[model samples]
Target chain A: MSKLAHMFLLLFAMAGITYLIRMLPLVFFRKKIKSRYIRSLLFYIPYAVLSAMTFPFILYSTGNFSAAIVGTAVALIAAAFRLSLIIVAVLSCAAVFVAVLIL
Target chain B: MEQSPLKFKHGIKDGLPIGLGYLSVAFAFGVQASILGLPALFSTLISMTNLTSAGQLAGITIIAALGSVAEIMLVQLVINSRYFLMGVSLSQKADATFTTGKRFIAAAFITDEIFAVAISKRQAINFKYFIGLAVLPYIGWTIGTVLGAFSGDILPANLQAALGIALYAMFIAIIFPPAVKALNICFTVFSAALLSCACYYIPFIRNNLSEGFAIIICALVSAAVAAAIFPVKEKDNE
Candidate 1:
């Protein structure tokens, strides 16, 4: 299959799932979720998912292992300081660029 | 209950910062899309249709890995499920003006930032305000993607490689603030990371589990375990 066609199919599936998840609940369900387990699970899911996606994979992101490590460290520190997403991302990328140069 | 032009203007005013923030992250996504050899138009369309950062990034992985349709659908379901909660939460904030038709229209705009801004409003939201709030960010996100996709082609190889970490950095920025606030969240993040690391390293598991599936498993297990252990109080639920 063509790359464009494949991408479109994936996009359609993603868009459809996402739209339904948001729209169905908003349009039909007015009640707050009652279960504590579900609520806690929901609260924690984003953090967990992000963590899983970020680590290990991030180490491979920059191609250079040392550069990626530098980037990850910078990212962690900047984010811990409560920096905005843009600032943290830029700092991390900048750190990697420097690491690539020096090493 | 009537939708007022003034309120719509206020919504646009509120959305500006969010639009600005989306620019950098969306640019990273665009770069990643280009790296994956996706056309700029499709990358922009992903932003236009999805309006999400993590989900789109995950979609890129699935596409790059040649994951099946069911895989993408399932991954999107797991990753974007937070929107379900946001949508349900925002439903209470909608005034009588939010008719069924309006609800459908508004649903497309219910992003994390948009929902946060909408829910924080003192007054109940109307369709006009919601639309106004979503427009600028949508435009910003698409524009950023376009810029990134085009620029990725011209950037030096070293620089493009460095920029590859941009989305992951954003992910760290997102999870860190919350992780620091609560001990349970800290544990959840680390455990998920460890699990994901294992998946990446272990030969047998690594060979069998696709990237999408590994993420799904790690996230669900870590979250479920944390939820069972922590069981955040009802009022603490966000």
Candidate 2:
């Protein structure tokens, strides 16, 4: 198949998966769940997924690896202090921009 | 579910920050997709259909690399599998007013940021509020992608390069607050990092398994460890 056809097929499948993952539970289960294991897993998911997506990867998401490291440190520190998300993001970008300029 | 003007307005109010955040990240996504040789309009369509960052990026990368259809499906499913858990967790908190059709439609917008805000509300969530919550972010993400795709050439290289890191920083902001709140969360993230790092550094895993699968494995290992060793016992629908 051509790339456009490939893209169309892939997107259709993506929509299916995204919809299933999100829709099934919200639609089928109406009442409160009593499973402790499920609850604990859900509670930990945000941190687990976020960390998996953030760390190590953040070290390379920028233009330069060293700049990414510098930006991430600034971001962690800024976020720890309870700065807003936009503020933290901007500051992190600035840290990288400055690092790129200096180095 | 109730059609309260006040609730819809509050949802929009709560969603602005998320929309702004999505704008920057999705803008970067558009630029990144274009740099990879995908058309801008197609990239925007991806954003509109996917509404996810990591999953969509992974998909685009695979497409650019000429991966097979099976690869695309597997990669997206693995990366986006977390949404299943989130949906399950939200099921209990969802308002009774949501009909089947509304639930299906609303679930499409159950993104991380939207979920974070929705679940934290002290009151029952309504369909109108939830729809309102997703509107601005949906608009922002789509518009940002379009702008970046068509006008990305207008931007200087340095700023474009810098914008790439915004998504990672946003993820950091999301995770940091929760990590600081609970020690168990810190442990969970730590374990996840260790697993992800191991997958990246280990010669066999790096080549043998795709990045999408590695993420799933790392997350599952950490979450399973957390659930077993430090199970949190909050009542669902609380």
Candidate 3:
């Protein structure tokens, strides 16, 4: 198969999987949801997903511990203070990039 | 009395920033896709169809890395798993007022930013507002990809890196507000970071795992661990 064909097949598979995962809960669980535990579990999922997505890239940018440390420190401070997301992200990225450049 | 057209105007209002933000990031993705030797149109179409941030980003990486179909599917599932929760939460906001078609349409356009803005609105999420919200971002994402793909030559390399930062910044913006009120979120963020680092250093996992799979593992593992340790009390959501 051609690379384009291969890429499309993969994309279709991904679209199907993603839609199923996202849609199932809403469609299947549409009626009165009785499980308190399930509801509670659902509440934390977003936070967990966000963390998993963002944390590692911040640390491993330069393949060093220090860069991650400084980047995390800057992000934590900025985020904790409720700085704008763009500002905090730019600062953190700049911090990592600069740290990598300097060290 | 018919609701004023202005009632729906907010969707466009809120979507504007999101649309502008999406342009740069989507463009970056297009450039990356081009760099990987994929046609620019492919990247733009993916953005149009998927309308997801991390999933698309991971998809390109996985495709470039030449991962298997199973791995790609699994990675997409894992990376986008949170949307399941978001969809459920959104259903509550949508209430029974939404029909199946409406739900599907909303589901397709539902990015984290869009979800956040939609849920925050005091009014019922009418179709008009939802379409308004989806349209601009869709245009921004598609056009951005096309532009990036075509202009790959003229753009400076550093600018692309800077544009990539918009995505992370968007995440921070989304995560910060709620995180301030909740300690679990902070822990979850840190835990995710730690897990990601471990995945990076661990030779076998680093070498064997595709980016999408790595993301799935990190998200599920960290969320699972956090759930176990800090199990949200049943009363909290109530």
* lDDT of each residue in B97-213, candidate 1, tens digit only: 889889998998888899988887767787788888998998889899999988888889999999999999999999998899889999999999999999999999999999998
Cα lDDT computed for each candidate against the true fold: 0.90, 0.79, 0.69
Q: TM-score of every model?
A: 0.96, 0.87, 0.81
Q: Which stretches of candidate 3 lie over 4 Å from their true place?
A: A25-28, A59-77, A89-103, B1-7, B35-37, B95-97, B162-166, B172-181, B233-238
**CAPRI band of model 2?**
medium
- Write one digit per residue (lDDT tens) for candidate 2, span A1-103: 8878887777777667777878888888656547788777766765776677676778877669888888999999999998987788889989998998988
lDDT, candidate 1, equals 0.90
Interface RMSD for each predicted structure: 1.0, 2.4, 3.3
| Number of clashing pairs per prediction, in order | 0, 2, 0
DockQ of each: 0.85, 0.62, 0.44
lDDT of 3 at B10: 69
Model 3 DockQ (Cα-based): 0.44
Residue B95 lDDT in model 1? 84
Residues B1-238 of candidate 3: C-alpha lDDT, one tens digit per residue: 1344324576787799989877866776676576656677777778777888778877877777666799988877767766776777677767454678677666777777788787776655666777788778888988988887777656565444434444555566567667777788767766776787787779988898766667777777767766667777645652
Give the candidate order by descending lDDT.
Answer: 1, 2, 3
Residues A12-67, candidate 3: write the lDDT tens digits.
87778877776776556565346654554556666666666666664443345686
How does candidate 1 fare on TM-score? 0.96
